[model samples]
Target: MPKTAALCISVLGTGNIGSTFAFQLARTGQHDVTVIARPGSTRLQQLQRDNGITNHRGEHAELRVAASLDEQQPYDVVIVTVLAHQVAAVLPALQRSAAKCVLFMFNTFDPEQLQAAVGEERCAFGMPFVQAHVNEAGTLKATIGAGGQKSRLSQQRWVAMFKAAGLPAVFEPDMPLWLRCHSPLCVAFESASVLAVRRGGGASWQQAMRIARGVHECFVLIQGLGYRPYPSSKKWLAASPAWVLAFVLWLLSKNFTFRELLAGGVAECHALIGVMIAAALQTSVPVNVAAIQAMNPTA
Candidate 1:
C-alpha cells in the first residue's frame, strides 16, 4: 500500500514499544490506529482517560484504544510489539483474528515456530532499533533512527508503513536468520545490563569479559547449526577477537542510555539462552553452557 493510503492497524501491547508505534502511526492521521492494553493496566486507564496516546511533550495522537483484540473485526494489519515470552499467550487470539497480516516487532532467536502457527504467508518479522519508554504520567519518550540507525523489517509493505508513520525501518531479506544471529549478542548485552543495573550503573571490565565469552559461545553454537551470522555488523561481533569485543562492550556498558534501553530485558536474555542451548543439542556444537549460563541474571 502507498504511504498516503489509509489502513486499519491494531497495535497489541501498550508498553513502551506499543505506545511508541501507536503514537507515531496515529499522528500520521492517515491510518486507523487502535492500541490494545491489558484490561486492568494503568496504561489502559491512561489511554482511556486521555482519550489518546501522548508523546513526552504532552501532545496527543488521537488514536483508538482497546483492552482486547476483536478477532471478528477485519484489520489490515496487527503489529505485535510484545516480548517473545509474551507471544505464546497472544497466539490463540491472533490465530483466530481476521487480520490480513501480522507483523511481529521484537527480539527472538527462534521465529520459525511462531511463523508455523501464524501461517507463513501473512507472518512478518521486525527488529526494532528504537529507544523508547512510557514514563510516569503516561507520556511517551522515544528516539528513532538516531546515529543512522534503522530497524529491520522482513516485509516491504510494513517497512513503508513504518517509514510513513515517521518510524525508520529497512527491509531485510532473511529476517529469521538475522534475528537468530542477532540473539547471541542481544542476550549478552541484556544480561550485562542487568548486572550493571545491580551495580548501580557502573561498568565492569570483568563482567564484560565474561559476557564476551558468552557471546562467542553463542556464536559458535548457532554457526554449528548452519546459520550464517549475516549483516556485516553482526558478522563482526561474531568473528571479532574476544578481548576486542569485550572492550567494545565495556565502552557501551558505561553509557547510561545504552544500559537503560537494556534494563528489564533479563527475561528475554534468559529465554534466548535457553533456546540457544536447546538448538545446540541437535548438533555437534560445543557450547560452553556454563560460561553462557553465568550471564543469566540472578536478581
Candidate 2:
C-alpha cells in the first residue's frame, strides 16, 4: 500500500476503545475516518457537535460521524471495538458492509464464532493496549502506548495503518491463544479490584493471593485444554510460586492508576470469565474457575 494512499476506515462503537482509536487515526489525516454510532444516539450527536474528539490533555482530532456503514462505498477496514459480549449485535451490518477487512479489537475467548459470522477471510483479531475511558463530557481520557509499547493485531495492513497514525502495533501470529491466555489474568485483576472496592479499600494481601491463585488455575486450565499461553511471559504465572505472584499483585493494587483501570474493565472482565469457563467446560477440562465465577455471580 502506498504511504499516501488514503484508506477509508470505519470504527464501530463509540466507547472508550473506539473513540480513542478514532482520535488517533484521525490525527494522521492520511485516511478518511468515519465513526459509526447508533442513529440519533447522544454519542453520535456529541461527536457531530464537537466535530472531533479530545483527549484528557485537550488534544483534538477531527473525524466524521456516520449512523451506519455505507455499503455503496465500502471502507478499506472496519474496526470493531465493542465489548466481548456486544460483537454479535453488529455482525449483520459488518457482513453486509463493503469493508475489505474487519478487525475485532476486544477481549474474546470464542473467535471461531465471530470468524464464522463475518467470514474467515475478512475477519481479523486485535487487542488495544491503551487505557482509555469516555467521560460524561465526551472527552476520551486515554493513555496510548508510547516508546516500544504497541497494540496487538493480526494483519499487516492494519498494523502499518496504526503505526503510521502514531499508534504502535505488533502482530500476533496466534491471537486466539493470546486472547485466551489473557482472559483469566484480566478476570483475576478485575475480580481482585471488585473485592477491594466491596471491602471499602484497595486489595488486601490476602485478596491479592486469591487473585494470583485464580490466575495460576486459569493457566493450568489453558494447558489442560492443549494450548500454551501465548507471549511466553504468561507462562511465568504458572511457573512462579503462589506467594511471589501474590506479592506482585499486592504491590500493583496499591497503584491508583491500576485500580482505576480495573474498575473500568470490571464488566468486560466478568463477561470474558463466563466465555472462558464455557470454553473450558467444552474441553472436558476439570478447571476450577469458581473464583472467577464468584467475581460477578449475577452476570
Candidate 3:
C-alpha cells in the first residue's frame, strides 16, 4: 500500500484572502479545505450555497465551508487570514485544537508575539504578493505571493504546496525582514492612491510611477537595514532617481482603475506603512524618516 498522509486545512477568515485561499486549495483537489467564518455570517451561507469561487482570469468550482473551529479535528495545517485584531481571539482557539501546523498567510511582522501565542514549532508566516479583493458580489481574484524570494527549509513543504496549486509563492528564511521591506511600498502606494482619489486624482500610467517610487523608498530602507530587497513590478524605481519616484506618483494619479483597485481597498497599505515606521522607530534607522513622516496622515 502506498503511504498515505492526510492534509487538512482550515482558513480562519472568510473574506477575500480566506475565501480565495480556500478556493485555491480546493481547486487543487488535494487538501480538504474548510473556511471558518463567524457563526451565522450571511456571506458564509451564501458561499456555501454557491459552492464556487472566482480568481483572477479563472474560476474555481464548488467547495465546502466550515463555520466553526470545533467542527474539525487534527488539522494538518491551520491557515489564519483574519484581521490583526481577530488574530488574538483565533490564537486561543487554535490552542484548544490539535493542529500540527499553523501558518499565517497575511501581515505578521511582529514574530515575537505570534511565536509566543502559537508556539514557534507550529508557527510560520506567508506574505501573498498581489492586489486582490472580494467585492459585494462574492467574486475573488489576484492570488499571488513573492516571486523573488524563497522560504527556509522549515517552510518549503507548504510553499511547495502553494506553488503546486498554481499560486505564486516563495518561502524566505527571514520572513519578517521580507515583510518589512515588501509591505512598506504596498502600504505607501495604496494609501497615497487613496489620498489621490479624494483629490479627484485618477490612476494613470503616471500613478504607477508614483507607486513605484514609494516602493523604491521601501527598498532603500530595507537595504539600510541590511536585507536584500525583493523584486517587484516597480522597475522604474530600480533605474530612476528618488525625484523620479515622486514624478511617477504624479502620473499614476490619472488612472482610475489603479485608484479603485488598490487605493479603495481595505486599510492594509496604512497598516503596512505603520509597521515599517514602528520598526524604524525601534531601530533608530533614519533612512527615509522625513519622507515617511511626510506621508504620515497625522504628521
Candidate 4:
C-alpha cells in the first residue's frame, strides 16, 4: 500500500452504490480513491466533516473528496456509478477526463451511446451485482452479492483489479447482451417489488404470473430484434415453465430483505421498461404492454 504504488481512482456519483465502491476501495489502502459529491450539497459537506464514509457496520473509510471531475487531473481510472438516467449529464466531462479508462458501472441497455461519447477504447462496461442502499442514518448498507455471486465486468483487467482490491468480480465477455437479456428480469422483479410494497407484502398470484408472462414475452421480443438470449440463464428463463418462475418470484417477494433491496428502484425500473417498450415497437412480436406497464412503477 505504498503511496506511489496505489492506483489513483475517481468515482463519480456519491449515492449508495458510489459510496459503497469508494469505501470498499479506500478500505483496502491499495487505491487512492476520490469520489465526486455535488458541490454545495449537504452530502459533500458531510463527507468532508466525517473525513470519510461510514457503512452500516460502523466501519469508516477515509477517501479524498472532490466537488466534480477535474478533466486535467491524472487519474488511472474513473468509475461512474450513477443511475442510467443521470449518465448522459456527465458524459461530456467523462469524455474529456484524463483517466485512462472510464468504467461505467450500473445497469445500461444502450452502452454503445456511452462508448461513442467517450471513445470506445476508453470505455469499460460493467453490471454491478452489488446490492446497496443508504439509510436515513446516512450509512451505506451494502453487499457485493448475496449467495456467492460476483460483480460482472466486461474487461478481464478490471476483473483482476477488483479481485485484488478485495471485491469479487468475474469477467463477462458479452456484457451488453447480458444486460439486455437481464432487463426483463430486472424490470419484472423491481416492478413486482414496487407493487408488493404497495400491497403490503408479496405480489399476488395473479400479479406474479403476470410478471412472469412479461419476462417470457420480453425475451421473445429480444429475439425478434435478432438477439438471442445472450447468457444461458436468460435462455432458460425464457424457455422454462412460467409457473416455476412465478413461484420463485412470489417466494422472494415475501422475503423482507429481498423486497427492501428493490423497493427504491422505481426510477431505474421506469427507465429500463421505457427502453424495452420502445424496442418492442420495432418487432412484430406482441408484448403485453399494458400488463408490463401496470407492473411498472411510475416516476
Candidate 5:
C-alpha cells in the first residue's frame, strides 16, 4: 500500500467495537473502510440503506458495508472485533483472506490459538480503549478511553495507519501478559455486578470485599508464574490496602452506568473467567481464587 493512497481496511463484526471503529475510520476519510457483517443482519441493511451508522452524539458518516470478506480484492488490514468466544468461528474465513495483516481487537486469556489459526507473521493483537454499545435504536454510544487512545501489541504499519487516522496507538510489549493480568480484574468486577443482581439491589460491602480479595489473589498468582502484572496500574490491587480497594469497587458497583454495562456483558464476563481460571490452573500455582470461581460455579 502506498503512503499517499488510502488504506483499504475491512472491519469484521458489526458490534459496538467494530461499528465505532468503522465510524471513526470513515470520518477520517484516509481509508477505504468496509464493514463486514453476517448475511441477513438487519444492522447491516440499516447501515447500507443509511450509507453509514450513527453514534449516540448524533455523529454519522458514509462508508461501505459488506456481508463477506473479499478474497480476490485484498484489504490492506482486517480488524476482527467479535467476542473472544466467537473468534474460532471466523478464523477460517480470515485465513482465506488476502489481507496483509489481521488484528484481533478483543480480550482473550489465550492468544496462541489465534496466532496458530492465522499464521503468527500475519497476526496482530490490539485492545480497544473505547466502551461502546448499540442502543435499541441501533445508534452506537461510546466513551473513548483517554481521548481515543488504543493499545496495540506492536509497532507496525497498521499502527501507523491508525495514528494517521487520528486514533492514538501505543505498543504494549507484553500484551499477552497484559491481557492475562487484566482478565481477573475485569471478571471480578463484572462478577460482583452480577452478584449485585442476585442480591436484588446494588453491591453490598461484603460482595465488594470478596471481589477485591479475588483480584488480589490473581495478582499474586500472576507474580508466582514469573510475570510482573502488565500495565502497572494493576499493581495497585496488590499494593493498596484491601479495605481501600474494596471501597473503590463498592462505589463502582453502585454506579448506574457501570451496572448497566456490566449487565449487558454478563455472558462474556463468565466466559473470560472460565478461560482465566483454566489458565491459572495450568500454572500449578496454588492461588486461592474461590471468590472468583464462585461467581460462575458451572464454569
Candidate 6:
C-alpha cells in the first residue's frame, strides 16, 4: 500500500493573527508547522525564545517557532495569512515552493488575480469567522468559526484539528462572500469610531455601538444588493435584531480590552467601509445604494 502523506505546513506571516493561527495549528498536532516571516526579523526570534507557544492561557503549548522555507521540506499546505497588500510580494516565492496546496485566509475582492498567480488547483480560501487583535502586551487573541459545511471534506479535517486545539473552527459556504460581508461592516464601524476619536466628539463607548450598528447596516446594504450574504456567519450576526446588535455593541465597548485591541485602526476601517458602499452603489442592489446615499449625502 502507498504511504499516506504527512501534512507539512507553513504560515507566511507572523503578525498577531498569524501568530494565533500558528499557535493553534501547533497545538493541534495534526501537521508539522513552520512560521515564515521576513528575513532577519525579530518576531520570529521572539517566537522561538518564548520556549514554545501557549494558548487559552497556557492550556496548550506547542514547541515550534518561525523558520524560513529553505530550512524545511516542502509543505503540503502553505497558508498565506499576511496583510492583504503583502500578498503579491510573497506570490513569486510561493510559486517556487514545493507545496501543493495553498490556502489564503484573508479578504480580497479580486480572487481572479490570485488564482491566476497561484494556479487554481493549488489554492483555497480561508474565511475567518471571529474577530481578535493584539493587546498592549502584544498577545494574540481570536475566536474560531462555528464550523459549517462550506469547506470540502479535507478542509474540514484541517479545521477540526484547530477545534481540537481550543481555537473555534468551523466550515462554511461562500467563505469569500462571508469574509467580505464582515469587512464592510467592520470598516464602517471603524470609520465612525476613528472620526469620533479624532474630532474629540464621541466617547469610545458611543463609537463602538455606532460601529456595530454600522456593521449591521452594511449587511442590510448587502442583502439590499440581491446577493444573499454568506449563509452561516450571516445567520449568526443577523440572529440579533438591530436593538440586539446595538446592545451587543455597547456591551463590547464596556470591555476595555475589546476597544484598545480591536478598535484602533481608523484608516483601514474607512477603506473597507468605502469599498462596501461603492460596491453597493455600482451594483444592481437598489436598496443598498439608496440606503448608503441616504445615510451619507456626500455619496
Clashes of each: 0, 0, 23, 0, 0, 6
lDDT of 1 by residue, 1-299 (tens): 24657889999998888888888888863688999998898989999998888787777898888999999989999999989988888999999999999999888888998898889988999988888888778989988888988889998888888888888889999999888888878887887777777888655888888888888888888788888777888788778888887887788877788887896898888888888878777788677777777667662
Question: What's the C-alpha lDDT at position 17 in model 1?
Answer: 83
Sort by lDDT, best first. 1, 4, 2, 5, 3, 6
Overall local distance difference test of candidate 6:
0.58
Which segments of candidate 2 are over 4 A away from where they belong? 1-4, 56-59, 146-148, 295-299
lDDT of 4 at 55: 86
Q: Which pairs clash in the backbone of model 5?
A: none
* Index of the highest-TM-score prediction: 1
**Residue 256 lDDT in model 3?**
78
TM-score of each model, in listed order: 0.95, 0.90, 0.72, 0.91, 0.85, 0.67
Model 6 earns a TM-score of 0.67
- The per-residue C-alpha lDDT of model 6 at residue 289 equals 43
Q: Write the per-residue lDDT of candidate 4 for residues 225-293, one digit (tens) a residue.
A: 888997987888889988888898888888888888887888889888788778787778776666556
What does candidate 3 score in Cα RMSD to the true structure?
5.1
lDDT of 6 by residue, 55-134 (tens): 44655445455555542356777778775556777888777777777788766544556778778777777755445554
Select the stronger candidate by TM-score from 3 and 6. 3
Question: Scored by CA lDDT, what does every candidate get?
Answer: 0.84, 0.78, 0.63, 0.82, 0.75, 0.58
Cα lDDT tens digits, model 2, 1-299, are 23546778889998888998898888764577898888888888889988878877878888888887776677788999888887777888888877888899987777878888889999999988877888888889877784457899988778888888767788898887788888877776776666666665677877777777777777877888888877778887678897787787677666676776676666777778777777667777677778546545133
Q: How far is 174's C-alpha from truth in model 6 (Å)?
A: 2.2
Question: Between which residue pairs do clashes occur in model 4?
Answer: none
Q: Candidate 2 clashing pairs?
A: none
Superior candidate under lDDT, 2 versus 4: 4
Q: Name model 4 segments beyond 4 Å from true.
A: 1-5, 284-288
Task: After the best TM-score superposition of candidate 4, give how far the Cα of residue 71 lies from its true spot, in angstroms.
Answer: 1.4
**Lowest lDDT block of 10, candidate 4:** 290-299
Candidate 1 vs candidate 2, lDDT winner = 1
